[model samples]
Target: MSNLPLTSNKLLSTLSSSDYERLLPHLETTDLPLGQTLYEPNQPLNYAYFPLNAVISLVNILEGGQMVDATMIGNEGMVGVPLVLGTMQIPMSAVTQIAGQALRIEASIFRSTLQGNGALYSLMLRYVQVLMGQIAQNLACIRLHSAQERCCYLLAMMQDRVGSPELIITQEALSRVVGVRRAGVNEIVNTLGRAGLIGHQRGKITILDRAGLEAAGCQCYRTLRAEYGRLSRP
Candidate 1:
């Protein structure tokens, strides 16, 4: 898996071979545990992490202490965007949403290397744009969609990030991410379960009806995919 194309990630893979090789030496493989905070709100970022299999969530904590995931990053993208934007501090908190591995690079090193006209810098910029589109769509979804629709969208997004039908998460944690109460989440979960769209046991959720889930989601999911496709540019 380590030897598989670093380009498996659209951002890294889009780089020219020579450019990728130059940065390859700096990429260090590391394990990411579930719920691990990569960066706290308003904190300085130390490194940029490119997931090989991990999923990271960018969450916003409101003044009232309410939390919701603004966007998600996975093997298709990288974390620590502040590094590329010429800042060390992040406004939102980043945390590992799933247990997996990633390629990490020091912020200083990445910034220095990315300077000047280079494929790496271009790829990073495009990825950031794609990420912004996802966040914007999610913001709208949360405002206009039903809790059940948002729940389906969230699960579909998670499945895409992890490339698995089963997700290991709890109602309490999910409530925080979806910006809903525990009871609301439980009610939706129970509805989906009874309809045979999903199966939940303990903290694990298994998607049983992919078609049904897609039907249940708002336009946000498709919007996210379209934006990524536009930025990825094959």
Candidate 2:
């Protein structure tokens, strides 16, 4: 029997049984630790990862080493899209934003499978389109939203991805992921805590009131969720 766990990953789980079987032999379960670098800027990808509960951040570094988080991939998507789509090198760096497990497959095998002109290829193309939409939405959010609104949106999104109200992440790390300064992150966090919208400890946060958070966050979150729901549906 194949040892792969009953996958919670949206992409993999949505695959047709025949498509799943075709890819099964190449998949191996892997532990994705926090802060793990999956790929670096301009680096050749070796594998694609479908995260079950983990979240990966794609960061783009500026000339002076200022890094901005471009997008995030969780259970709904896979890493190494460029590899399967014909690009040999990835432009952004990918790192684990939260610790969890993923099913990984060799990039070569994945690419060969993509050439089969089957359901998997079509599905991956749709996923890539949805992922691009997320990136575009983030760009708009960053330009038009406040730090507090963005923070709430981010926390709310993480809650959905992790399937829990509570999350284990330090403020410093959160700041990096949100592309905000530590003081700004603290200010937003403090506001949320004071309002009882969320509970924050040293390195953990819990969503005490999802409704409150939804009200505080930007509309981009809802729009993004709707798009993902529409595009990623089986």
Q: After superposition, how far is residue 187 of candidate 1 from its true place, in Å?
A: 1.0
Model 1 worst lDDT window (10 residues):
1-10
Score residue 65 of candidate 1 by CA lDDT.
Answer: 88
TM-score against native, each model:
0.91, 0.94
Alpha-carbon runs more than 4 Å astray in model 2: 1-5
Residues 1-234, model 1: lDDT tens digits: 344345556667667778888998999888888889999999888899998777898988898987777878887789988888889999899988877778899988999998953677877888888888778777787889988998898888778766789888878877866778999999999999999999999888999999899898787777877777776463
- The per-model lDDT (C-alpha) reads 0.83, 0.85
Residues 1-234, candidate 2: write the lDDT tens digits.
Answer: 123354678778888788888888888888888899999899889999998777889999899988888988888789999976898688889999988788899988889989984788888888899899999888888889987888888888888776678887889889987769999899889999999999999989999999999999999889988887876454
Q: Candidate 1, residue 49: CA error in Å?
A: 0.9
Clashing pairs in 2: none
**Residue 135 lDDT (model 2):** 91
